[model samples]
Target: MPKAKVGRKKAVLSGNHYTSRRFDVVAVGASAGGFHAIAELLGPLPANFTGSILVVQHLDPARKSLLADLLLRHTALHVKQAEHGEIMLPGVVYIAPPDEHMLAGPGKIQLAHTHLVRFSRPSIDLLFESVAGMYGSRSVGVILSGTLKDGSAGIRAIKEAGGVTLAQDPAEAEFKSMPQAAVATGCVDYTLPLNKLGITLKNLYEAGSPKSYG
Candidate 1:
């Protein structure tokens, strides 16, 4: 993969299809020990957060997802499992449904149950890729605690699209594989602990400040 350059050309999608920068979508991915980690990350954001949040979590399709319900206790953001064709809105968190791929484009969300990527339906790459495709630099990709490399490529795609990418610090991750893989790609812009991510993201939204590692 090529190193991302600022203001570079937008990536091409299917024949002549291109995306415009919408800049307020946040895409997050995790697996294994995701529930608590995700909650912690979202906990600090105020009810008035100005960005839309989308998440892809590894789950058994046979079991019903309680993630949206779980997160409702943590953040003031309106949380729900994604519904096909619903408009993406700020301050709302959309959870990818089990056994389905969740994709987003300008003003719309699409769900597909056709196939899996990396042996996982609702692949992190699919969500991050679509968000990066549509939002460009205005997008944010977060890879948290998990047991595989599911989110690595997606963060890279986000970086190449001029979006910001964050990985949970491996030292702080309950399961380090996913965040470690994402960091190894050198595309991630921040390797932050879960406690700091929400506040940092809030700073990004409020001031457009360039984040610095300590």
Candidate 2:
């Protein structure tokens, strides 16, 4: 009989703690001058990153969103508008579609045309709250440049869930209101410049399975 071939299994770090600890989901919210901010924010992720990233950047519902297309030009991560029931994948970025509220569930995405929250259809609060409930301490919440108070409550929700929360430095943001509001909540773990946010996240992810936001 001919010898049968077997595929090699990818090696993963093994330990009881490593198996239990996870930092696998990152959720980001932005508005106002967010298009450019998000592009810069996502530009630095290495191709092999294992965390799935979900983003909500407020957009005009009456107009088509070119956000995914625009972002695909600058980053290594696969970018696309979130679809209902879609399973999120590592190294991919999902953006909320215009007019639809996108949410993270246990292992899938849920898209809804629900009532406007805080006067926005794709509310940052809605997305962050869902992500917090699903991923808990494994989640990362980032608030970027924007206006009004959209991401403040969301980041607070993330903190309450034991997730790591971050905000772009208000002084560095084109529109400081959003980041300022998030910082004022006292829930954020880090307030960093746009250029430093990626590297900071990389360091946290590389610190080997974060068990606590501390």
**lDDT value for model 2:** 0.82
RMSD of each: 9.0, 11.2
- Candidate topping TM-score: 2
Q: lDDT score of model 1? A: 0.82
lDDT of 2 by residue, 1-214 (tens): 1111111111111234234447878999999999877888788777767788899999988899999999999888899999999988888899999999999987678999989999998999999999999989889999999999998999999999988887888888999999999989989877777776776666556664633321
Q: What TM-score does model 1 achieve against the real structure?
A: 0.86
What lDDT does candidate 2 reach at residue 213? Answer: 20
Once fitted onto the true fold, the runs of candidate 1 whose alpha carbons sit more than 4 angstroms away are: 1-22, 209-214
Q: Per-residue CA lDDT of candidate 1, range 81-117, in tens?
A: 9999998887889999999999987767899997879
Q: How do the predictions measure up, each by TM-score?
A: 0.86, 0.87
Give candidate 1's total backbone clashes: 1
